[model samples]
Target: MHIRVYNTTNAFTSLGATFDERVLLGRGPTSSTIHGELRHRVGSLLPQQGNDASYAQLYIYDPASALEVRNCRNQQLRRDVLQTIQDTLLQVNPFVEKFR
Candidate 1:
């Protein structure tokens, strides 16, 4: 999994230097949250935004590692990972809307 945060408001870009190639946003025994290494990464930006910014966008790149059948028999692991991500996002930004 990898993510990128784009701040249309420019407030998030004001943060200091760039982020490392891989910052652990969150992790579980069978899942890991990865993000792109950029001047302003999602991990750093989210804390600064504080769930207030209405224009921030997150681009998630799932490598499908957890979805591999051999790695995740019955697909339960994949579902767990997806649920983890959803729960994490909602927890971080309660204002986020869910459309399924």
Candidate 2:
């Protein structure tokens, strides 16, 4: 399972980074609470902004190696992770391109 969100807001990217760190540091509201023992990656595709681009792409996914050991528990965890990501997106309201 994977997601590629374009034009993501800085808040969303920052939250993702924080979540990953919390998962590592065992502090704060880590998404791992909903999905235990699952390997996932969620971060900005471009850490550095370009000359004219203010937004970035957010990538979220479980690595292929992790997928090899997939089971019912893993499937449920993936679903929960997706739900969490969707909720964050709804709050941040990113990926909305404006047209003039």
Candidate 3:
């Protein structure tokens, strides 16, 4: 998965001494098959920097599934991915709130 930062507020920056304006969420070479496939399909998730705000978006690729799936298998994968994202956000909510 990859999370492209959309914006960060001054309040957020004040909490940290150093901040990366952009962040990559997963640890894999961009040349890897899955990454390549996602890049091809979704284009770029990272917006031009300086568009400061407070939100991020996750973009993931499953080469075996269509972007919009009509079948059971792909639907299951979508559900699982959604669940994972929700769980992750719940786990991170407190840490995120700390910057506020």
The CA lDDT at 74 in model 3 is: 29
Q: State the C-alpha lDDT per candidate.
A: 0.34, 0.34, 0.31
Report how far off residue 72 is in candidate 3 (Å).
17
Q: Candidate 1 at residue 52, lDDT?
A: 27
Q: What lDDT does candidate 2 reach at residue 58?
A: 25
The TM-score leader among the candidates is: 1
Off by over 4 Å in 3: 1-77
**Which tens-of-lDDT digit does each residue in 1-100 have in candidate 3?**
2232111110122122233323444665543223222211222334357631222212122312322221232233445454454445445666334322
Model 1, runs deviating above 4 Å: 1-77, 94-100
Q: Enumerate residue pairs that collide in model 1.
A: none
Q: Root-mean-square deviation of each candidate, in angstroms? A: 14.4, 13.2, 15.0
Q: Estimate each model's TM-score.
A: 0.21, 0.21, 0.20
**Which candidate order results from sorting by TM-score in descending order?**
1, 2, 3
Query: For candidate 2, lDDT tens digit of each residue in 1-100?
Result: 2332312222223332222334556555535433334433444454455422222332222222222332222343454454554456545554522110
